[model samples]
Target: MRSGNPVLSDSTFLDLGSGAVLSRPADAMTLNGTIAKTGFLLFLTVLTAAFAWNQSISPAGPTAAAPIYMWGGVIGGLIVAFITIFKKQWSPVTAPLYALLEGFFLGAISAVFAHLYEGIVMQAVMLTFGTLFAMLFAYRSGMIKVTQKFRAGVVAATGGIMLIYLATIGLGFFGINIPYIHESGLIGIGFSLFVVVIAAMNLVLDFDLIETGVSHGAPKYMEWFGGFALLVTLIWLYVEFLRLLAKLQSRD
Candidate 1:
């Protein structure tokens, strides 16, 4: 199986040898288990996100301080995510922690966007979940098949996007900006639209990977891993939506 998610790659469900094999078939991964785990992680994310969101909106809260939570969430979540990726057995513990940390980051950043763009955050949230369910239905109904060509195309597009983002950030240090891609102009809006579409397509790849993992009878802990991977993609999609909406609003 293939996925554009860095965590849900082809080798993610590979058996590590005899030690990786589950003695009981019942202990193997299941689609239901992954759904349950994903729901739990989402709950954790929302719980912490509410806390940060509340802080951001507080009367005495300074927007400047929000970055503490934002950077903390971003850096800490990355660390935990890397640990979970390298040590799949630790996913059950790390996945929830990753969600919580990521919530801190997402909430702070989202609050900043909300402050600037009024109800843009809500619009982005609605669109994100809307796209998610729509994609899920499409995948389940076989409206979108996980063909090799499809997977390859999505992966290639994702890689290209990542490279462009890295280059943009790299140029930032030299006091240079990537025109059009970061502005509120037509080109910038078009770029964000393209990114949003690519990010949404990644969900299809993620779903395919989880279904494949369950079919392969991966370890139960893989459900946590799968859930974490999905969360990563969801977060990416939401953030991109926020950026796209913000750019569109800026044009007004």
Candidate 2:
């Protein structure tokens, strides 16, 4: 099944090239290794994110620091993420770099939301992880099946959302605002809720895809690649949670 995650769904595993260089048992991807790599990457992300968060909340304020950390992270993270995707073998190094860079962007934006709605970042963080574990539980217990139909539906929805975002950003250059965005209205809240659900569901797809890769005896370095793909979904989920929480808080 094609995963909704861009990195994973790009058919990276399919690049095994007719299995001539199939991984040896001792050098194949494993669940434990992937989990460990993921945890380590998360640690790097949080460490840098804390630093960026502190910077954003400093006397300089978000506006003054936005270009430095925010844009730097955004641009740098994308560059590294693309490099990792195109050169999956380089993931061992690029994955950690991507995480650290992504943290800056996440932290700066989260600080902006926190500034607008007190306690929002903490609440969003909680909800994001809560959804992650909940989805993991559902997946492991077979409560959530990653059927072909389910994967296709998710991919379609995610694609539509990406298009919407692209259009919104494109229009922003012309000073056009999308009505359902940042309005704190019923539509805005509902839209955010939907995106959060989709983001959470992508985790199930990621899990299934990772298991598939391991079973196929993918190279061990794929552990890092898997972790990087997961981080992409998680960062997306967390940002969506922040937006959802902020919208709900604004209604109060």
Candidate 3:
């Protein structure tokens, strides 16, 4: 399906013409692409809305969000995660939903940060996109490669980061604050930098996966799936960049 011509659309996967090729392989890519794009688009829309609202509310008060709005995003993200895990076959639908929910969560969380650090949200977004494009260019220029060793190391580092973050959150339940989590300090800056590196490496994996899907002649929908994965990674990288920049500015 992906061979021959480079028609970039999801409908190309489903041919109704009599005696036409089934193109199952093409369907795979198309499905993935559609899902990824749909999810990411929905997420961006929601995120924009949330960010706008957050900006509007900032002048009125420090903490203006309803608990339900915050909780809705949290619960929704969990639900999307569960659905994606249990029903991989339904990624076309679930993936985009996850993006929407995550957008909500991110927008809300970002709002909270905006309260403490003025103008940080915008700064973070620009940095995030900037980093994403820079990494993409590096990969395309052969400056970066997704080697087996690199993949393994990045995955391991990412897992470690997730664990540490979870631990930090859990500690919060007991009213414990790991020093420098929000403070401007060497440790905090160092941690943020590390996360940024991991996040950038993740883009390598994302690029490799997309190329693989395309090489295998995956269906048009696969673009959506591919886009979704990249979007998620970019969002994460952007937030970390935002936090790091904020910390640096606070220190100055």
Per-model CA lDDT versus the true structure: 0.89, 0.88, 0.65
Q: Is candidate 1 or candidate 3 better by lDDT?
A: 1
Candidate 3 C-alpha lDDT tens digits along 131-249 = 87788799889998767787778777887887888888899899988787557799889989989988888877777666666655554545655665666676678678878988888
Looking at model 2, the pairs that clash are none
lDDT tens digits by residue: candidate 1, 206-227: 9998888788788889999999
Query: Candidate 2 overall Cα lDDT vs. reference?
Result: 0.88
Candidate 3 lDDT score at position 238: 69
What is the TM-score (0 to 1) of candidate 1? 0.95
Candidate 2, residues 63-124: lDDT per residue as tens digits? 66755888899999999999998899999999999999998998888778877888998998
Q: Give the TM-score of candidate 2.
A: 0.95
Runs in model 2 lying further than 4 Å from the true structure:
15-23, 59-63
Better of 2 and 3 by lDDT: 2
Error in Å for residue 210 of model 2: 0.2
Question: Model 3: runs farther than 4 Å from truth?
Answer: 1-26, 30-48, 51-56, 219-221
